[model samples]
Target chain A: MLFTIAWRNIWRNKRRTLIVLSSVVVGVVALIMNDSLSIGMIRQMFENQLGSHVAHMQIHKRGFNDNKVIQSVVPDQKRVEEALRSTPEVKYFSRRVVTFGLVSSAINSSGAAIIGVEPDREPNITIIKKSIIEGRYLSGASHEVVIGKKMADKLSVGIGDKIVGMASTVSGAVGSDMFRVVGIFRTVSSEFDKSYVFISLGNAQEMLELGKDVSEFAIILRDRGLVEMVKSKIAARLGANYEVLSYADLMPLILAQMQMYKESMFIVYIIIGLALIFGIINATLMSVFERMQEFGVLMAIGMKNSRLFYMIMLEALVIGVLGTVVGMVVGLAMYLPLSAYGIDLSMFSESLTSFGVGSTIYPVLTLQSIVGILIVIPVFAVLGALYPALKAIRLEPVSAIRYV
Target chain B: MNIIEIKDVEKTYHDNGVPVHALRGVTMTVERGEFLVIAGPSGSGKTTLLNVLGALDTPTKGKVYLEGEDLSTKSRNEIASIRLHKLGFVFQAYNLIPVLSALENIEFTMMLRGIPEKERHERAMALMEELDIAELADKRPNEMSGGQQQRVAVARAMVNDPSIILADEPTANLDTKTGANLLDLMQRMNEEKNLTFVFSSHDPQVI
Candidate 1:
């Protein structure tokens, strides 16, 4: 009966109830959408870094990651290959000859990381094959090269154009070669596009004069969840001489930013929740005051102050539950299709790429986010009702009955 | 046996900084099964005295007792319990919870007493039938006429079989015929169930 009364009391003023409910619903939906977008952006950035060039894990010679030099070539290439081949989790691996150099066309020149990749193996480890906006990926053809769109633009070179690449060899000599640009690729990171160029492994090895020695082995796992296991296994096989690192270890700054964004989302939720709290408090207080005479009659008829308090609290709870459920349903309705096809931000592609994010973003809804809303919204609603409930219970029946 | 006793009761209200005396040095008592009227014009403290008698307000300078227990000394919760179990009320405005139907309003006091749903429903139906309001049981207070709503309020007051029913101008909003009918219904209940009735009104019929 108390439940029935509380439930019916809310609808006594339908417009007021709905207005308050709408505020809560809007708050919930906004929180869900905001959280999902942030998660999606972070997830996309993480995946882009891995797919562009980082792969799932990498095996480098000691001190190579900290200081990329021609001298720090992989010490035990055969052992690393053997371990990768033996590990069932290793889906694909590519050996690269990496060096910093200058690429020059007839019109311009720019500094670049002149990477030498095995054409067939590199495509499986990185997104360079799919990222080709013009021309084609490396074909293992001698003197063939693939440069990023920004780099090609800076060098004023295009497909079939000849460009000269210069780098230091292992013997402290400047090794330089001329190559034809076979491809121009663009990735999520504009900075990466502006500075990296790819050529055939054999051409790069000969140009850098590193015989049978590679700079690093980039490994992609069949299941990304096994990245740590695969890295540990390969590291154990190659011993301490070879440094095996996962994508997380290789990109600490990006991961840290992702963490920071997630933490900041809680503050956003708090702000929204606080706004809803005030709204609920105002609406409930009005309802309570409007029915002062009725409440007085209830008190005179022997209804306990505690019962009256519970009744008001129960009304807020009903509103909270109803608002949350409807909001989640509506939010999910909006989220489902957006998550599937993603929200296209192509108009802001340049800015997105500069931030290392793709033009299209897919929103992700997590179990933790859903659970947090379920707990938080109702708790806030109840909190908002506290003052009004106390006020109702404190009213003297004799005076309240006479309240105009 | 006396169901209520009041000794030198006083009630004063502070409007802004000035004091207004609503009740002063009033003494009263009513025996069980008694049908009594506290009649006076408006602002004569008739309702105030009834409020004191009903345990809805504490006397400013006197002791008000219900069945030998001093109400002023009891905690607020204890007073509420006493009201729930021992006293009933009918207000001038019909004051049925607008959200509840006539039958629900009648059953509300019993529900507060933690009575089982089936028993309260049965009792509410029986009382509604006795009042010739069984047909309007499903109607809300707003859906019913003033007389019908007052009957439901009377039924609500009697549902729990309280020791005393405190009515503050219960028929103020009703027509004369309706007012007379309501008084006759209360008179019958007082005679039949030995229920004590306390009425505060300026109506000559009630006086």
Candidate 2:
């Protein structure tokens, strides 16, 4: 009977109920879709910009990561490589030898961070090959190189162009050699595209004088969620010889920046929720006060005030569920398209890159986001209905009857 | 048994700083199978007295006893239970839920008590047919005329077969013929079912 009354009353003023339901739907849908999209996009940016390319987890020489030089290379590479291969979670594992060097093109010159990687295993572990926006990816070990899109523009360099590498070789000689640019690629994040350059492990080893030694061991896991577990096991097995750092540990600065952006988005979500709650509260309060005479009549006919209370609360429940269903559909309709192609933020490339967020981010929908939005929304709507339900129950049948 | 007892019931209201006594220490008793017409001119406290007797309002100061139980001692829900099982009401405006059809309005209290749909439907249909409003049962309040709606309301009141039926200005919104016909039907239900009928009205036709 309570459910019937609530359902019937909703249709009494169809237009009024629609207006409220539409607002609720709009709020809920926008919230659900937006929440899903943003999370997915950020995850994509990190996996592409950091985790996938760099491996969700990495292993390093215990003290070598802090110093980061050719001399600090972890010597027991064969053992570490075999251990990573043997682990079921490890899908791809490779060694990295990194250093800073000055590269001079014909017309311009700039200092760039060079990543030396094995040509064979690089494509298997990272998305670096697919992101090549221009020219061909690296072919084999040679004096050939691939420069970032921004670096190419800044140095007036392109495919078929020659550049000079000036750095200390392992033999303590100032090594200088000219290398040809094989490709130029741009990733989603501007900072990465602007500063990063790639070269073959053999060429880097010869030029940087790293003899049979690499400083970092990168691993791509079958599941990104297993990063911490993989890192812990790898670290424990390697003992005092190596340090295993998750991508989170390797790039503290970028992670911190992304965390800050998330905090701001959370604040905005709260404001929207608060405004919606207020609207519902106002609507329900007015509805209760307006129906005092009706409630009095019900009581007059031997209807219980408690039943009236249930009736009012059920009305809110109806509104909340109706709005949530409508909103989820609408919000998803908007979000799916945006998440697929992503809103092009190319215009703000420089600033976004500086903030460590990709210029193009496709939003990802997760179960947690949907559940969180649904659970919190109904509770809030019901809470908003509280005042009105209480007010209806508190009406003195005699006093209200006087008005009737 | 005296189905309803009102003792020294006094009800007062203040209107714009002036005291108005809607019911002035009036006492009344209603017995089973009684057909009582409570009549007074406007402001004579007839509606106020009816409101108290119907348990729609508590008197400013007084006691109301229903079927040997002090209504004041009952919880609000208990009072509602009594009303659900034992009382029926008809008003001048009919007051049918605008969204419900005539048949649904008649079955509403039974629905409140969780009565099965088939039994309720059978009873509601019979009641409407008896009042000759059977064809209008499918019409909503707005779709039906004043006369048709009043008949439906009376049918709704009778469908519950409650211990008592209270009518407040039942004829105020109806034409002479419609009002007379509705009153005659109530008189028949009172006589046939041995039902108690109480009405408060200023309209001569209702009296």
Candidate 3:
């Protein structure tokens, strides 16, 4: 009876009820859209960072990340490469030899990190080819190099232009190598654009005067969730001499920043939900006051105050539940594409990428997030009912009956 | 045995700063199954006494007992349960919940008793059938005329089969003929069910 009465009571004034419920629906939809978009963008960023930049895990000689010295190269390349391939997670494994150098095309010169990669395995790990705005990927046996778009622009070089790379070797010897600028590529990260230059690993090794030595073996895996576990297993198998770092371990600052942003967004959602619940509570209280004569009659006809209290609360719950369910449904529909596809910030791509956000920001959806909205809305609704229920029980029979 | 006992009940209200007395040391006793009428002009303590007797209000001073239990010590919920199980009330203006149809209004009291729907529906339809408003059972309050609505109200009042039915100017909103017919239906219910009738009115026939 309580539910029956409460349901009917909502439609008692269809226009007023519609106004109240529509507000709730709007709040819910807005929250869902925001949540989905945030999730989707972050997921895409994580994937891009993992597959194109960091890979799942890396094995380094002790102290390599902190001190990138020439002597930091892994000593046993044959054994390390074999051990890495022994695991099923080893979808692609390659070596990268990195050093700071100046690339000059006679007209200009700019400082850059020259990354040596195997022609056969580099594309399997980093998305270098897809990023190529012009020219072709590395061809084995050619002393060709790929420079970042920014580097190419600064140096005034294009595909087929001769460029000279100069760097100091880890052994304190000045090293210089000449190469053809075979490709120019765009990177999502501004830092990558300003500093990164990719070349065939054999050429980099020869130029740096390193005898078949590699700085580290970068690896890709089937699932990113296993990054930590894989790192640990590799560490256990390889012993203390070798160190392993997962993507998060390599980029702690980015991961922490993302986590903080997510938490702050949740706070914003809570504030919105709280305000909506206040509107619901106030409306119900006003209606109760307006319907005092009815309550008085109900009380006179043997309707217990408890029953009356239940009736009032049921009405609130109905609005809460109905609004939340509908809102989530509508919101998720928008969330999926908005989060995954992101609201295109392409209009300001350069400005946004410089600030770390990509050109497109997508919205994402998750079950846990949907459940959170479900839990929060009803709690807010019930919280809104507290004062009104107290008022209903305390109203006087004679005076309330006299109320028109 | 008397069903109601009021002892030295004094009721007052604050009209702005000065206190106004609605009932002054009033006393009354009434037996079961008796038709009692308390009539007075507005603000003459009639409704005030009725509110106290109905356990919907407490006297400013003194005590009220229903079936020999003190009204003071019982909790608000206890008072409501007492009202539900042992008393029934009818009022002017139909006073039906606009949301519920006439049949639902009659089942409302039984619902408060925690009776299941099937039993409550059966009892409601049976009473509404007796009042000759069964044909209008599904109609909301606005759909029925003044006379039909009053008859439905009477059916709701008697549906619980309680010891007493209190009507506070039950015919105040109806035309004279509709009022007369409404009162006749209540009087007939009083005779057939041996129901106790307690009402406040200026009508000589009702008194």
Best by TM-score: 1
Model 3 lDDT per residue over A1-404, tens place: 77888898888878878877888888888778777766666665666667556887888887898887766888788878878889887788899887888888889888888888888888889888888989988887667998878788888999999999888776779788899988888876665777878888888888888879988899888877788888888888888778788888887876886798689778977788788878988788887888888887777766767778878888888888998988887887777666555588788888756644578876666787788889888778777877787788677666677777
TM-score of chain A of each: 0.96, 0.90, 0.93
Q: By summed lDDT, which 10 consecutive residues of candidate 3 chain B come out lowest?
A: B198-207
TM-score of 3: 0.95
Tens-place lDDT per residue, model 2, A279-387, is 7788887777666776776776656777777788899888888788778878788887987788777798677666556777677777767776777677777877988
C-alpha root-mean-square deviation, each candidate: 1.5, 2.9, 1.9
Which residue window of length 10 is worst by lDDT in model 2 chain A?
Answer: A44-53
Off by over 4 Å in 2: A105-109, A167-177, A223-229, A251-269, A285-291, A353-359, A401-404
Winning candidate number (lDDT): 1
On residues A357-398, what C-alpha lDDT tens digit does candidate 1 reach at each position? 889999999999999998899899999999999998899988
DockQ comparison, 2 vs 3, better candidate: 3
In angstroms, give how far residue B74 of model 2 lies from its true place: 2.7
How many clashes (backbone atoms < 3 Å, residues ≥3 apart in a chain or on different chains) does model 2 have? 5
DockQ of each: 0.89, 0.54, 0.78
Candidate with the larger lDDT of 1 and 3: 1
CA lDDT of each candidate? 0.91, 0.79, 0.81
- Candidate 1: stretches off by over 4 Å: none
